[model samples]
Target: MLTKSSQSVATIKAEDASKNCILVFDPDKTHAGKLNAILDFLGYDLLLAHSREELAHQLKKYPGLLTIIITGDLSETEQQDIVNIVAREAEHILPVVLYSVPAKNEQPVSLRYPPSWVAVKYPIAHQEFSSALDRVHAHFAHQQTEKGQRPAHLFRSLIGRSPAMQHIRHEIEQVGPTDATVLILGESGTGKEVVARNLHYHSRRRGKAFVPVNCGAIPRDLLESELFGHEKGAFTGALTAREGRFSLASGGTLFLDEIGEMPMDMQVKLLRVLEERTFERVGGSKTIKADVRIVAATNCNLEQMVADGTFREDLFYRLEVFPINLPPLRERVEDLPLLIAQLNDRMEYEKHFSVRFSPDAVSILSGYSWPGNVRELANLIERLGIKFPNGLVEVNDLPMKYRSGTGDGVSHDSQLDFFAEAAAAVRSQPFAVKTKPTVAQILANGQDMKSYVSEVEKNLISQALEETDGVIAHAAKLLGLRRTTLTEKMRKYGLQRPREGRATG
Candidate 1:
């Protein structure tokens, strides 16, 4: 039994606990394990509640845990107990997804359910599981955002918690207010455009439009007309007068992507516009005021281009006023978990689909150079959602370039329980005994303290070794045990590190 909270019931902040903390209860451990595997891979924090008391305790402890999943058959008494406990949680209301076998031909809807509870038939399909998650996510996003309870600048589109991401976000806030010519530098697919949009959203002109034009994508001959608009009969294809990117941006932002690829003639013209804030329409003498903030982005070396006499020096200096450099994905590998979580959330919320990458799979991805940057990572996430839709993606599941480690051409599918699976996946915790074994479940089964502690120790050491691919130093670091101590423990337990291609407990 757990000690109960004596603190008076009071209002709780939704952001009190970490986001996406899901608490689940199921009498059938196997079903719970399956959910654990799915939820962990999908990038959620899963906490198993052993009893009604434990469930209530966790809800009160983690107010950010807004979603509760209760599975298996609940007796009328047990159901009432859970309802009362949840109702007592006055601080934050929690949504419940209940899975129960329908007696005879009775439908799930025919049964009585508590407030904030929805029932799924006994045999829950992948689709229903995803739908349940969507409902909870939608409720949280819509309600919290509508009430203004959530921060205005949470910036779901710009996902990261790493220091690098924090610095970038801070930079956006600092430079977003200025009207200076901004140059965004990053490798292709590193989200230069995404940063530009963030700049626009935070600017005073957010209410206005944000126009993006790929300067390199447009033809060299027509680039002038595209930037400054053209009068009717200006060119062979110009049938009528039209607003160019400058006119369309009209007091907002003009994001010039691949600006390095602009012809030298256009660079000279662009520099004049930057210096004078005015440009004449092609084949028209009218000088239109360029009421737009210039935001140019490119993966090329503009400085080198200037030295090579390909790009104009004046234009290079003009666009370099406020440079924002985006670091490549490989440099900030720590942000992978958050990025994957955000991507998975997008897929689930939009398509009613969800998937997860095994800890080993994520570890393997971390080792890659990520030449394509975040775009490549996003594409891979989408591909996994399509390929293994609504399931787990193990190391072997990844494409050839990403495949490595002991998982190569190997399968450990039927080996460990979901408990070990999650602990291995977590980078923060080398081993997390999410829910400690209760005295009743252990002592009542004729277990003693000495044996229990040793057993638990052996299991954790085994799991850490397996997760680190039987590497002694790595496993020791994960277990927080010195190499000598871990080796001694292995000897005491009659255990030995498995071979490179295979691991066992």
Candidate 2:
């Protein structure tokens, strides 16, 4: 009977020992002992580390550690140092929980730290700590699932691992092999063309040409001839017979970019060709069969256009068979680091120059609205590569407006006024004017000349800043203004760098 009782006790102790352990680091030995006692009573194994070296040793010793809890006595710098060390030494990224006593004027702990890092106040109740720990565990599990769900490669050109991107990849996989008409919708610079190419590359027509035409860029009169070949002497400038996009893209894919910009008349013709799979060249009687897949993309809302009577309802339905909407850069901020890395790689390959962005620089970028989206990011990366050329991009290297998270610093009222004036100018001008309107003529039109001029000045400054990747001195030089004068204007316009006390260099 005694032997059986001893075995039962040993088995209970062994089971208790098998529970997951948490590593705690506290400078105050008494406080540490108190925490250990509390945790022990709650059936958790605890490992205490009093110094940096001891913490490192404990991390290795407890490979199956559930989490790390740090007490509030450490300064911000010390906390950062500990985090850095943890990041470097850990076999994998670990969830970190910080316990700090808030100052009288300090913001809430939740607001001060990101969601990925749990922050709790000192004198934490057992139940509160347990709840926080449960949340941390759930977050870590979700991260692991997300990591597993990521496809090895979505496409050669597209790069992202967020859930949004994963959905897009799944859509592409389902739709790529089919000959269905696809409509890609997104804002400008959101990689619509890249998506189209991926679909084409994966389709049955991969061996054939992938032709892309920008309907909005070509004149309406020439668009018809561009889509369908024009015969010799078909028009005043037709010197010889030339094939259109349809013939060039036969047995392949035809990408209609900015398709919403197609005129109403052209939409009818396009609908007819799509329905019949046949079209005739301009001034030619031959009916050419179009053995091509259609992939249309537009930044404008086709449904809205149809409702507005600008786009044909039938054509919209035909193209909307398979729709894919790309999330904007701002929507997928988690992909910024990956994007930055890819852009750096591309810069190195194409320009033979590269630059690395500091973590703070990336953090600042991730907070911006990214109005121009991925294209804007790519442009900025290229500019950075040119400027730094194998240098590190610190937060101060970012433009004042970007650093400040205020894009171009244009007031909402001013922006509205600028657009209003531009629309009015367009409405008043003749569609087929023989010559450009002079500055005086433009001012004579119903526009506040001063505001219009100021808008133009602001636009110029914004463009210069964008071109220089927010470098003040470079922008000032491009504008032929003294650096101080440019700085004054930036201030006057409410443009400020992301952070103060950082050099504008």
Candidate 3:
């Protein structure tokens, strides 16, 4: 018989145990020794706990423990106590195996245990114990796989660890399985379509098609026909009957991007379809069932549009059943490091080369207000990858606007000082010519010097606005220009900031 003193004497500290270590609780020294020999022969690490107190201590010390194994004579109450401790402290549900013999005059050992726990007859054959251990190992392996699995829609996209992103992910998981209409609202380039795709992939309609149509991109006259099919001879170019996006996306999802840009007349028709779950072809009177989940996205404020009588209130309400607002890149600046790493990994995969950004480079990039959001960041990263495929990108390696923070709201004197600092940093490092052309090369390539200079000036001004987060006075100071002069230039270049909302980060 396994004695408590013998079992307790061999107790192993949970902190020193390996990740694959198993917690074995068996008070009987004989049974514990037998199981220990079996496990040790199999090259498994074991942590023996003789009592509830020891078990609790081991659990607290090793939150990353793999599984638990209990053998010998364990009362039902003791078993319950062990399970309670495992369930309460474990990061995830752990598989537990209980081996026990029937007591005198008692019924056969019951297999009754928690879903995560398995009970087996004690004094079992070595083969049976081996099989049980195999099952436990398999269960642990499966759990590890599940922990690492990403949502199908999240493959190669939608990367972030911020609270806002985490909340968005939770909302997607909650709403993706339903057939309700989802309205996604965010600024432009905020990956609204990505969210829609994620919803479709996670929903029951994943196997079917995912048809996306940008309402703003399509001509107003053809928008209706694009959404609903047209019959033969429906219009000037209707040579044959053709299925619309709704028909193409039947039994799946239809992502309506920039829904706010739809015309008022089209909005009424859309509202009717949403209400009835059916639509008629543009040139045909036959009503067709949509059978497609609607996911609408917009950068415009639909409520404000409704107040202005531009967007139909009924359609807005129908689309807003489950609204998900995506935060812009500037709002989640803390996630920049992860985003940069992911972006660079993608670049390396595609280009067969990689570049590491220096601390200063990262600082400059993170400090800027990403007005264009993730899309702009992706573009900038790709540009860098193309320019320097495999090299350390330092502060001076960054663009002038980024290095000097010319758009980040520093005073004129401060901006000048930063420029001096940037120039010194650049001078300290050896200059390396990039594959891209210089301004002199462009001039020699027969490009108009005046137009080229004007374009460069315009780009500088745009970067300034972006860095200053669209603060006109701050941008003017960064550019060392008067507010009126900056305003005039902004007007000349047709640069306008969108209406402000609640700032984050």
Give one digit per residue, the lDDT tens place, for model 1 in 199-281: 99889888888999999899999899889999998889899998799999998999999999999889989999999999999
In terms of TM-score, the best-performing candidate is 1
Give the TM-score comparing model 2 with the true structure, all chains together: 0.52
| Clash number for candidate 3 | 7
Tens-place lDDT per residue, model 2, 377-438, is 98998888788876667779997766774454322222223323322212223222235443
Deviation from native of the Cα of residue 381 in model 3, angstroms: 0.5
Q: TM-score for all predictions?
A: 0.61, 0.52, 0.53
- After superposition, which runs of candidate 3 have C-alpha atoms over 4 Å from their true positions? 1-154, 406-505
lDDT of 3 by residue, 1-505 (tens): 1122113424655443433467687776555644554443233456677777877777777665657777666677876786677777764645556555657987876553675465555545433544455455445545555777432211555676556798898999999999999999999988899899999978999999999999999999999999998999999999999999999999999999999889999999999999999999989999899999999999999999999999888888899999999997755654565576556655554455555565346556655666688888878888887887655677788887766643445323222222222222222222121443322334344443234445665788888878878888877877766587678777877987533552311
Which residue pairs in model 1 clash with each other?
A: 41-356
List per-prediction Cα lDDT, in the order shown: 0.69, 0.69, 0.68
- Which residue pairs come into collision in candidate 2? 400-496, 400-497, 403-498, 404-497, 404-498
Task: Write the candidate numbers in order of decreasing lDDT.
Answer: 1, 2, 3
